[model samples]
Target: MAERKLNGGLKAALEYGPILAFFIGYLQLKDQVISIAGTDYSGFLVVTALFIPLMVLTTGLLWALTGSLSRMQLATVVLVVVFGGLSVWLQDERFFKMKPTMIYLLFAGVLGFGLMRGQSYLRSVMGETLPMRDEGWMILTKRIALFFLALAITNEVIWRSLSTDAWVNFKTFGLTAAMFAFFLSQGRLLQTYGIEKDKV
Candidate 1:
């Protein structure tokens, strides 16, 4: 696939369309029962089975459109297939439920590893978009890494202590909101550390 610049709308669709489909699939199928190989499965499992393939499809589409996938996107798709496949194969949803926790923890660990080496992987990924001094990058990376750990813990607690429906809602909306708020709260740091681009 050749590298191509994607318009914002197309990019967003490729990134988020599968998640929206999964949510809608679960909502519409939750009351229905599915049978596979003479065993009954809940709508959650069925939706997850569908979601795994949808995720793969969207990921492929993204690669086709952009000629590459980010590490984050690759990790997410792989985890979804692994955990979601287990949920469908074993007729249990717990594995799928743990996917978010696993992803967040993995991300946190990766960032922590970078921090241990006195490097900012976050800056490597976002530096072009958010230019800042090395000190600023290190500070932001530490904060984001800690935030990912907190999100991992939060996912574990919510899934274990709450209803499946509640967990789904939290996974879909609560996490998104929390991330948005976290970044929004970093406005001060962004402003303080941002390097002004030279005007043409």
Candidate 2:
């Protein structure tokens, strides 16, 4: 089927619905031990397992709607499968906890490498959505790259030093909020360099 572009609200839901599911699932299952067959599993572990399929489903739906998945979205699903699979199989939450760190670091590395090459990879990814001057692209890319790097470092410290519940809370809410705030803070730059309304 040819994919049809979805409205912003629907697109956002597909992108974020899985993560929201994980948070709600964890809260409902926290502190409980459930038996499957003869093996007992913690609520957090079960939620982690469920989260993998949910993410996959949402990603699939996104592709169905848009007829394409960004490289970043594909990478995210792959990481979730690898880390979440290991977490479930090993009954260790640490593996799942490190997933965000890996994702953030990978993004930072990609952006940083582009910067080193005097390129704006972000422009390649988002140029269609937000047409702008090359200078604006470079500036935004630099800021986002640094933001991703900082998030990666923060993820490492939070997951390593904090309790599982605390880490989950940070992952579920804090990271999303941070990203939103970061992008919202960039409105002036976007407007300053964005293609004029008539030009677009």
Candidate 3:
């Protein structure tokens, strides 16, 4: 069966929905939570408490609507459940804060493994929209693997040293902008290597 085309905007929403939801929910509930919890409730804690289940539900709904979940999506769901559950169970918001770092590293490792196996799993996921030759796919996969590793390291640094709000902003917008810039820089190469419609 031919793969269904994903709407870019929908894809973006699905990818970032959890983070956005968490931020919005936290902001909305912050004062109420503080008042109820006797001023001892950290914003991060309030956010995580609400974020985890909401994310899981959102992801599941997306999967059902899409009719298929990509490997990346599957991995994300697993990680969110595991880490999010840990955060609630331990009553520590640190697990929630580190989720992005874990996700990036996990993707980096998966991409690296695919490269070692001479397969471009990243290409497999994106191939429909961004088709390319095998060589192009390999190069793209390697580059993205490295990019994910960098993101993981960057997340670690930000979360460990920066304030929670700073880290959240970086995760929500800064990192996304960086990824877009990186992809844009590769436009020329992608065009050169892209599979033509007739050829496809």
Return the top candidate by lDDT: 2
Give per-residue lDDT, candidate 1, residue 18. 80
Per-residue lDDT for 120-153 in model 3, tens only?
A: 9888788877879999999888998999999989
Residue 104 displacement (Å), model 2: 0.6
In angstroms, how far off is 113's CA in candidate 1?
Answer: 0.8
Assess every candidate by TM-score. Answer: 0.94, 0.95, 0.86
Candidate 3 vs. true structure, TM-score: 0.86
lDDT of 1: 0.89
Cα lDDT of model 3 overall? 0.79
TM-score of 1: 0.94
Worst 10 residues of 1 by lDDT: 191-200
Give the poorly placed runs of model 2, Cα more than 4 Å off.
Answer: 1-3
Cα lDDT computed for each candidate against the true fold:
0.89, 0.93, 0.79
lDDT of 2 by residue, 160-189 (tens): 998888898999899999999999999999
Per-residue lDDT tens digits for candidate 1, residues 1-200, read: 56678889988887778877878888998988988888898999998998898889989988988898878889999999999999988888999999999999999999999999999999878887788878889999999989999999999999999998898888877988999999999999988888976621
